[model samples]
Target: MSLTRLLFTAAASVAVLAAVPAGAHADTGPYRMPPPPFGSPDAPGADRLTVSVVDSGNGNDGTYELECGPAGGSHPDPRAACGRLDELAAAGQDPFAPVPAGTYCTMQYGGSATAHVTGTWHGRSVDASYKLTDGCEISRWNRLTPVLPATAP
Candidate 1:
């Protein structure tokens, strides 16, 4: 290539580089964009779920509607359930997230209880199931304690 053309290309590259602020390449910080209101359960479209249990030895088998923010519904303890959900979210954990695939869980059996939760939480869809079949499953069910009745078989 001609020296003049190569020099022109170099100068153009330098100009482009100089146009960007140095801090642009540096790690300014974690996601600067404001995040969803995980702390505010009362926010619209927050917690509105339905929990259903079948064959649960605890005798709490039945579907119950749950609403948060104002905290109302057929749920026995909307306040407590909402509190648990908010707490988990604030801790950077998704209370309704399923156990990861291939994860090892204890073979111990919790019970025959099986529960399903379906609805929207913090503007996200949730369709989680709970069963007392293994340690991980039991823990997942227990984490939502009041949401899902403390079942035993």
Candidate 2:
């Protein structure tokens, strides 16, 4: 092949390689989301709030999915929560993990029972606090919200 042709081919190959997806060249390593937070209010007949942790893959950039509901009731899906986590991750913020460590929820159920959640990412943890009120209000269980870093005591 002519020297000019070889050079052009090599440059084209380099550009193609560079355009490949990052995961294709990246090392396939295990990425984990933080554990769920603790704490729940009293309920009737096993009516306890539960939080679940989901691994959203490396695409989430160390974000997590937190789903919660009544202990005996069906739990909410983690996709919405995962989406929220992705947004936070994109903003260069780790919302799933908090500094001090703990689960937090910002849900306000118009009932007597409340649920709280906390998630961890990259060794950090974040929390949300939930409070129940009256009526049948929809509690923010599967939605992703801002997770504030806990202040040092």
Give the candidate number with the greatest TM-score: 1
The lowest-lDDT stretch of 10 consecutive residues in candidate 1 is 35-44
Regions of model 2 farther than 4 Å from truth: 1-75, 92-113, 132-153
What TM-score would candidate 2 get against the native?
Answer: 0.27
33-81: candidate 1 lDDT, tens digit per residue: 5556654444446568999989878668999999988788998888998
lDDT of 2 by residue, 3-54 (tens): 9999999999999999987677457666785443322122112212234322
The runs of at least 3 residues in candidate 1 whose Cα sits more than 4 Å from the true structure, single-residue gaps closed, are 1-44
- Model 1 scores what on Cα lDDT? 0.84
lDDT for each of the candidates? 0.84, 0.38
Return the clash pairs for model 1, or none. 42-69
lDDT of 1 at 86: 76
